[model samples]
Target: MSEELDIPEEGTESLYERRAFVIDKGQEPLRIDKYIQMHLEGSTRNKVQNGIDAGFVTVNGKTVKSNYKVKPGDEIILLSLVNPEHTVLKRENIPLDIVYEDDTVMVINKPANMVVHPGVGNFSGTLLNGVAYYLEKQNPGLDEDSLPRFGLVHRIDKNTTGLIVLAKTADAAAHLAKQFFHHDVKRKYTALVWGDMEQDEGTVTGHIARHRQYRKMFDVYPDGETGKHAITHYRTLERFHYVSLVECVLETGRTHQIRVHMKHIGHTLFNDWEYGGDRILKGTIYTKYKQFVDNCFELCPRCALHAQTLGFIHPVTKKEMLFESPLPADMAMVIVKWRNYIANRKEL
Candidate 1:
């Protein structure tokens, strides 16, 4: 028997597929939770238990408890959430800058302006859509329901360009998710922020939460009154007197952590329109200088941030893995412009 139930947003992970099974005629009794875990590659007993408690798992079309003992020829059905199957997922033929790929994981150098997944205003042309197409090629003749869903451990902003790792299998996704949750993964971002830094290095700690009024933006709640704990450690990479390029290491991953933390310290990312870095926040207001700044803005129109490096212990190898991507053309050009502007001013 098959049933499509209303998807509950909370208390459930994103589901990839629904599965049904029947106990062997001669099989002995086994706990439903353990039985499900044994059959599912990436699912744990706890996850199955959660499903059971939430009434996501049923026996003979009736919701059952985790400890329910299965009898011979008993019918079982599980509603697993997290990954949407291929039929519902939009597949695009977009090119992917694959950094590395194997049976377990894939790392891609995502470009600026590409959404990681589909949502609200972004219905297509996302990185995941492209990934679906790629995965379809790798696993041909597979049923649509059996196709692997996109396994994302973490995500960068829409405009933040650089390396993002994806799991190819259920086991890999579970392991990678654990690493991210425990803060075992190392993530580094390079950002060009407005204003000269008085200190060479510093750390920003605060609670980050959604803005009370602006639902689309995030803010740092300094009083620990709201939001999740976030930490960002930053060191000045190069200073251009008016603006500086900084490398930021994230201790905690929260929505807009780096962006909000930097802004909290009074150094907003350059060209970050949402955080008010798009205007002339530094340097002389002369016409020539204004034109120069405007030109730099045009050169790198998006937020001046890049996920430069990522390091983590490989789930399969138990060995360290590190990946890096150079600054894209837009960011590189703006950096050069800043360097020349600083040098020429010093010569005068």
Candidate 2:
């Protein structure tokens, strides 16, 4: 898997499985689900329903309703096949903001909202997809079936954009992954949370797990199941009456580690849609700040989260490197105005 494979050219979603062939010509008249079951192994009716909801299964180059019948020559694109575990990622001439690269590794300034790889609601336009193309363009001798060449070393949340690294060679990938597994890499972030923390610096230690009632969340409780241990260290960069700009360093990585931990500590990032942080500001606690946040809401419509810094030792060279990004302007006012609000309140 570390070896690169030639990815397919970047294009819009296709109707039929791009490279998958029909099980039999006689099955043409069968229902789409049945056709999928017959052609694609381990695919079932329930799996098809799940795929449809996830927007993975499509027909004739377009996503269609589940019950839609198929006709002769109608291409049946199985979204599942595009999965990195299934198909080789292909090149599509996608643009990238390459920060740094060498014989063994590549570093990128990943944009916000672009998932590192395909998952959940995002099946395309992922960093993996882009990297696949980049690798293909770099090495023409590489075969397409072995594509998706860039060896993914680590992953960052889709919304928390920042510096991310990938291994270009299998040896580099395995060595880099070992560093992560052993907690050898250093990672950092800058975020605008909803409230000023009590202390200027702190660390959160907790066991995290998915909520029983909610399908898409994590919780830390006294009686919670034994979830994975995660640690985050934070320090205040700026404080406002209702928010704080904090720098966080990860000692461990887990799903929604920062978002969940901050929310657990009662300071979720503003505009976070999933971890209960999305809302329009209305109070006059700081009108200027409210206006700023409201305007940003209109502009970006994402939580004030950013993986502003990244550092790790080169797997091949053993040299150290680091990268950083400034806090996006959308969440800047959360700190600027809140500082004024707190100062004015002190004046009273």
- Output the number of the lDDT-best candidate: 1
lDDT (CA) per prediction: 0.78, 0.66
lDDT of 1 by residue, 242-310 (tens): 899999998877777888888889899999999999999988968999999999999999999999998
Candidate 1 structure, TM-score to reference: 0.77
Candidate 2 structure, TM-score to reference: 0.69
Tens digit of per-residue lDDT, candidate 2, span 209-242? 7777796877775533566677889998886656
> Local error of candidate 2 at 78, Å?
30
Q: Which ten residues in a row have the lowest lDDT in candidate 2?
A: 8-17
Model 2 clash number: 17
What residue runs in model 2 are displaced by over 4 Å at the alpha carbon? 1-86, 144-150, 280-292, 332-348
Compared with the true structure, the alpha-carbon lDDT of candidate 2 equals: 0.66
